[model samples]
Target chain A: MKQSGTIVEKQYFTYGAAPDRLQLESGAVLGPVTIAYETFGTLNRDRDNVILIAHAFSGDSHVAGHYPTDREGDKPGWWDFMVGPGKGIDTDKYFVICPNILGSCMGSTGPKSINPETQKPYGLDFPMMTIGDMVTTQKALLDHLGISELRAVVGGSVGGMQVLEWCVRFPEMIRSAVPIATTMRHSALAIAFNEIARQSIMADPKWNNGDYYGGDFPRMGLAVARMVGHVTYLSDEAMRRKFGRRLQDKEAFSFGFFDGDFQVESYLRYQGSKFVDRFDANSLLYITKAADYFDVVDRVTASGPLKGGDLQKVKYLVISYSSDWLYPTYQAKELVQALKRTGQDVSFCEIEADCGHDAFLIPDERLTTLVKGFIDGVG
Target chain B: MKQSGTIVEKQYFTYGAAPDRLQLESGAVLGPVTIAYETFGTLNRDRDNVILIAHAFSGDSHVAGHYPTDREGDKPGWWDFMVGPGKGIDTDKYFVICPNILGSCMGSTGPKSINPETQKPYGLDFPMMTIGDMVTTQKALLDHLGISELRAVVGGSVGGMQVLEWCVRFPEMIRSAVPIATTMRHSALAIAFNEIARQSIMADPKWNNGDYYGGDFPRMGLAVARMVGHVTYLSDEAMRRKFGRRLQDKEAFSFGFFDGDFQVESYLRYQGSKFVDRFDANSLLYITKAADYFDVVDRVTASGPLKGGDLQKVKYLVISYSSDWLYPTYQAKELVQALKRTGQDVSFCEIEADCGHDAFLIPDERLTTLVKGFIDGVG
Candidate 1:
């Protein structure tokens, strides 16, 4: 479905009935799962030119363009700079599909989704999800679109986790894969940060044990979580360049109780406050947990690597940013090494950028060229 | 006032009567200030052997030795590993005095202290404090004890900030100074973490605008804040070695919502919960704010650098840890550079340790040797 506007309209695809429920890795079952997706460009008659784009933690299916009524400041899809007619993804030559993974709040099944049995928000009762579960659900959507073979699958961060999961679970389904700024398993440091974020949210009394629906939401907790997350998403150099020790509209130190004296503090406070308006606290909890549970080694070895078909022919492009301490270059190297162990064709690149893990989404000529070159070479 | 026990007994020194109030940096007057301190060893006849030890953010006047009736697991003192008769600080050679800084909850004039005007907890009414203010209060305690000059003033982290302040404020009073793992000014990244910690505390309903003294304290928020602080104190390598991806008492993934599946999460939770028991939430807010407000450059250039006495004569030893991202080695280098600019005698070292910002408090042979050598050289 196409809309007559600069923004591509989001389309929904549902599958699985009550008895044919999607069995979660946690043994819980979810049914009538709906996946929200947006497509750019036209699919070839054979549907062989289809490319699936998975989004990161806070991103959705809206990867490019803007809605018809979008105002001047309204953000176009996050990757609007790269996914266009002749941009990196090159909408003119390839059919690009972006899906908001399950367990996210953006028009997808998640903790915010209502439970059919209780008719209330799933909240904490939402079945625990993993990156494999997200990939499985997305695969069902591809099957529904009559795309048996995908030209490419690409993602970064948690989305990148899904991309890796796709390669391991259904290696024969995709011809090429790009997983950027992701890790096979969460590091102790990463888990520590995530746990602190979770603690920040759960500590807020407004949370009321995650049953704050139809009541005051845990905005303070969620905002704190976002503030913490935002700090990790940027490098020390990036923060120094952007905010530094600059004061926040004050001439010298306030020395007052709790004023935002530093520009960085003010910037972080703004980021935290702004995030509460758009993101759900429960969704943050669930999605972060999903990303934490992702371990490609466990999935690949669950039924023996040899039993997972002839995956040697799959082409892999792994990319990382030098300043991304959240998912540093070492993580991408680990993935490339793992892929090599399986005799897969893998190309790795570590871009020198101070933007940190968010570099994958940031517009950079090098990134655009590398992505375009990798996709073109897939032919 | 020597006590006959392994642990030095804490003594209180009160200053600033009703009319002769201590004017704070914020133009607020605070009177009847009390400082808690503990001294080890004996001061020579001329009082030329006194080595003042300033404590870090959460530390107190207790520097070394076990209390007579203390159990085995009871920590002797925050820096018990270093300050002892034969240890790094070398109580046998130098008289050691550790004072709980002003604005600290441990028997010092702080937010938790009663306001003589209202005969109630000061809470948020406590006048905003700075590292300079803390050093000034410490100097008052020394004056009351008839100690005119210190052999050396040493500390790490926030304590280090105070050490820098002493060098700039009362350079003639100290013969040597050692500021470890500290910055001349708070970095944006450091401020961001501190702001998040403050936010975590303030977001809790129990915080009650800092008036929870008579009611339930903001334990949850304080705990979350502690959790966040605890993460910054250790390096990624340290965390990997200590916790890694180990599970918390489970064979496999719990897949349950909000469960501390990872050992690191469990450790952080424990750290957070234990912190609230011994720490005052309001004091935490106030002290962290004090830390954020500390900028040595501002103090150094308040008037003319020449106006401050001959700070050039002070022997300086600035130390930093290699993996301390919170207060990285570069920060120590900056402090040394600032000292050198003023023509001060300075020695600098960046110890290679994976312990992160808390490396100073940890027992390391290199740190001990350097501290001993630096102190001995000051004579």
Candidate 2:
């Protein structure tokens, strides 16, 4: 239950520096790619006690604890409950690192970052990033730290895709993997939602084809996209239990065009508007495009079963939430099937939770126990 | 297998004339309301074979067959599959009436209609209309036709809500009722989707506070709203079976921000853009607001077991689809429970279909048979 104690410092590693640019999946090159990352605890002498935690879509490198500042009740890092001292991952025993994924605006080289050649923000000019590209940057950061083999690679939602990418692209670096509440690829329904979110962004004239860097932002479009994200992240049961037909302060219907004040409406609007301040619409379009294009099943199927490496060397623990219709439990099982077909060591569990895809981010006794047990068994 | 034969003419009836305005639930008054409706088949001498078919959200009075236009490939009516001469609500036997609900852009007097005082589009000035007002208009139309409802009333989705309103508000006017794929009230999840859809329209700059009647409409916002609606209307299974992860025209990923071209994306965009062409943005806001405000359970409970009406006189048929998550099967069952508690004769069936909320509108053998059998049992 203890915090990570002192705030972790966010360090940056600039790869593909200068003329030698990082070759993206689209055959385009991006240079001086800086990946923002933060690490808790310490790397062991063997450099084998590392656990990489990938962030979700629109997430940053700050995974746990707060930055050193003079503030009371400041919000802690995103996964503080699961990655702190004596917590599920036990930062005191293992070095835990989280890197901001590519195609995101969270201190990473994304659409908002300056193009080395043009000297302007990439905006729509940024090459589309893939999950493999994201994992490649993480591996680059690990190599820089002299950390070769990770004890485990863990992540949920879009972050989980990174864990799977690491499993296939660089299995030698992972002793174990935890891909939680994510799919090898998006189903058509998921694609529909993401497409709608993207359309919402593109529809805003303020977006100006993603070139609105210093002027008015596409606040409305980005907010709508975030609202769609929020709706998908939580399950029907969660919303039903949380808001139900509850109105705001008014006892009767507003009956006016713009003042119906349903509590859920207020919550979604707040979530959307707040997201507008922290996110870039172009980044959302790029990141979601990347996620929608991801398909681990094809890559794994093509690679064949684990190659020459021993199946026991790389372990995978697939976790899914029962109520996560966005990335339903069946998808996790599909992922498990794909992994097993590759002859990789795989363990699967469907956690009974009503919070939907966001369940892994929330603290639960069963989840903590399962994660701790898996980690303890790993190293 | 015959069509409705001749395309029925849309008829209009004016009621709630000026001076005596229709008092809305919000205490706002609207006057000289005009209800646009269409009728097929013939009313028997006893006026006892009437079957009122309410249309869904964004639907119109044209319930069966095509228009009077001479196009060879013209599309049929919205419910043509189930409302034709020899189909479910067989026009050959029962008199069928379909009324476009109030607060809609389709023929009915709505936000797009000219306000008497302003002599311009009501726009945001249009008073909010509820399911009750919609049913009230239909009742007025029936009175003008010198017909007393006897055979049955049928509808699905938002239309289903209207059907329920008619049951509780005018049980004495019915011999039976059919409400399909609907809820007595919206769940918080449903409310969340509706609220987000409303926000999408309101966020558009071209909306101009709903006064963009003679200028550029909020096409983008309205399209996004339609996209959201499309997502909710189809089931995950349906989407997966139809589109999967198929790409459009391209063999590989576009690797660009906007050209990923997942088939699902193409479909949703088309659906959204097409909706913008036919629908009024302000009407979506008002109609969804009214649907959100509807709570038949409260009104039904207050009426106390049909107000001592004969349980066998007015029968009820509640139908739901297996994969219609928007309304879901449980909501229909909930309506059944309430109807039974009120001592009204009720029959319930959950049709197994993977098409989601739109299943009832599509041609299905089981649904047609059920409707035919229920309507036959009525007269």
Interface DockQ of each model: 0.82, 0.84
The segments of candidate 1 whose C-alpha lies over 4 angstroms from its true place after superposition are A1-5, A298-311, B1-5, B298-311
Docking class of 1: high
TM-score for predicted model 2 compared with the true structure = 0.97
| Error of model 1, residue B374, in angstroms | 1.3
- Give a tens-digit lDDT track for model 2, residues A130-235: 8889888888888888888899999998999898889889876779999999999999998888888888888889999999999999999889899999999998
lDDT of 2 by residue, B1-379 (tens): 3333557778888888778888877778998888888888998888888999899998999988767763666677888888878888888898898989998988888999999999999998998789998998888888889987657889999999998899878877888888999999999888888888988898899999999999999999999999999999999999999899999888987776566488888888888889999999999999998889889887765555446554434688899999998998888888888777766678899998889999987889999999899888764
TM-scores for all candidates: the values are 0.96, 0.97
What would the per-residue lDDT of candidate 1 be over residues A260-318, giving only the tens digit for each residue? Answer: 88999889899999999888899888888888778887554342356555444679899
True contacts kept of 2: 0.93
